[model samples]
Target: MKVVIQRVKEGKVKVNGETVGKIEKGIVVLVGFEKGDIPSFLEKMADKIVNLRIFEDSEGKMNLSLKDIKGELLLVPNFTLAADCKKGRRPSFQSSENPEIAKNMFDKFVEICRKQIPVETGIFGAEMEVYILNDGPVTFILDSRELFQGGLS
Candidate 1:
């Protein structure tokens, strides 16, 4: 599983001209799943996301975690994040997980994330338009596969 975490003052997702999920002052999580991904990856990613110290402290230092700020989360399923472009001008999605497995893992990840903070989610497999008001423009990429393999560097 891979995720792009963006700190935002507000975020919302719309599909087919209808609003689906929205959040206020939180992180926008774009999640991607691969074939070999497992629950262990989901668990670790959730922990890392909630505990990541990206928020500023009293002294204006990046020392406060999402939990510390009691922030919410906007989770969006994005298999496109796994797109492979190494070979040609057009990106390939061969690394992406099948919809069934991806949906299962996406739900599992959302469930785990909900335990830590309030979570809002876009419809899985739906075309969505996301709106974000970024804070500090902070963004991060996390690969649960790396964490599971003890390959985090």
Candidate 2:
């Protein structure tokens, strides 16, 4: 699993010109599932993201977490995040999980996150137009492989 997290003032996703999900004063997460991703990683990543201290505090330091601010979350499924582009001109998606399995994983991740904070999500497997008003343009990339103690299980 990999996620690109962006702190944003507001975010929304549209599919075929119809807004599907929207949020305000939160972060936008673009998540991808890889071939060997497991269920355990989803809970760990969800905890890390909501409690991450990316928001600013009274001292102008990045000391406040999304949970502290009572912010929302926009989760977007993006299999392209798993693309292997090291070799050829075209990116290879051989490492991405099968769509059927990935969709289940994605749903599980979202369910886990929703228990912690207000959550919204883009339709899985849909072509979405995401609009984000990024706060401070702050962003981070998290990969489950690097985060886990023994790597992916």
Q: Find the candidate with the highest TM-score and give its number.
A: 2
Error of 1 at 18 (Å): 1.6
lDDT of 1 by residue, 1-153 (tens): 899999999999999999899999879999998877877888788888988999998999999988999999999999998899899799999989999989999998899999889999999999899999999899999888666696432
* Model 1 alpha-carbon drift over 4 Å, by segment: 151-153
Put down candidate 2 lDDT per residue, 68-151, tens digits, no spaces. Answer: 999999999999999999997999999999999999999999999999999999999999999999999999999998998674
TM-score of each: 0.95, 0.97
Best by lDDT: 2
Candidate models: Cα lDDT each:
0.90, 0.96
Q: Summing lDDT over every window of 10 consecutive residues in candidate 1, give the lowest-scoring window.
A: 144-153
